[model samples]
Target: MIRPSIPDRSDDPRVDVSLVVNGEKVMRPVSIRMLLSDFLRHELGLTGTHVGCEHGVCGCCTVHIDGKAGRSCLTLAVQANGAEIRTIESVAHQDGALHPIQQAFKECHALQCGFCTPGMVMNILARFEEEEKLDLSDSGIRDMLSGNLCRCTGYINIIAAVRRAAELLGRA
Candidate 1:
């Protein structure tokens, strides 16, 4: 009996990717195997974007892809080509002040280990900014933040922080 050999799938050139990062446009050559989280943290030096699970199960690698929250670990850097990418670092005042969401997180002691805070804050901020009128009910808050996971704080303080942030932003 003869066995078939596996096919070769190499010899592909790297793709040229261009993306607007934190309001600035950048162009770079990237390999097809590069992950968006690795690109942001390694290539761009944006360490604020944390990578918890390489899989999409954990939300620690979440970032705003064109104003919508998504898992960076699962996204290819090539897919982000010609798109606006917003990490946790971008969610701050132009004057270098902390964004209301960040401020609220600090004020409410929403984080302990600080690993999941960035993704949580980014996800919440995206929703808070997109929706003109937000309802800050307990169930609503739980549903909105359902994507983000927090091992510390049991999420009570995080929920309170998001509520306070909504109030501070005048969206509640």
Candidate 2:
């Protein structure tokens, strides 16, 4: 039997939201209470934006919203209307070439389980894009990456990869 759409509760009405995702314009009907994380993962099939802590603590749901990284778990799909959202899927080139950051992560062995890599990379991208002079100092890098949590790798190579990514980005 075909499943019918669930009725929207009064407090959770459906609304249309428009956003440019990964360089493509998209519009979808989403429940007003739908979190951006869910909208991106379920509705749009972009699973790279992982939702770790639904409360936004783990930072696994980070995404670039209008050129800045924001916790998708805390952002509503309706609130993202008319926004430009970038997910980790956009980090790679269309011809299967890994973006420099991705290559750095791979070559440096920055990821283990890889659950947090997407958010981590997006956060790094946000910092690099927003800052005038990229600071890769230990303390500076720690402060920028403090929000993202990874249980593996002990962050040794991740830090190294971030530094390497900075160099790669600088060469561009």
Worst 10 contiguous positions by lDDT, candidate 2: 1-10
**Candidate 1 Cα outliers beyond 4 Å, as residue runs:** 1-12
Clashes of each: 0, 0
List the global CA lDDT of all models: 0.87, 0.88
For each candidate in turn, the TM-score is: 0.90, 0.91
Q: Per-residue error at 29 for model 1, in Å?
A: 0.7
lDDT of 1 at 45: 94
> Which pairs clash in model 1?
none
Displacement of the residue 143 alpha carbon in candidate 2, Å: 0.9
lDDT of 2 by residue, 1-172 (tens): 2424434554766898999999999998888888898889878899899888788888889999999999999999999999999999998999999888898899899999999999999998888889888667888788889999997778888988988898888732
lDDT, model 2, position 130: 90
**Candidate 1 per-residue lDDT over residues 69-108, each given as its tens digit:** 9999999999999999999988888899999899999999
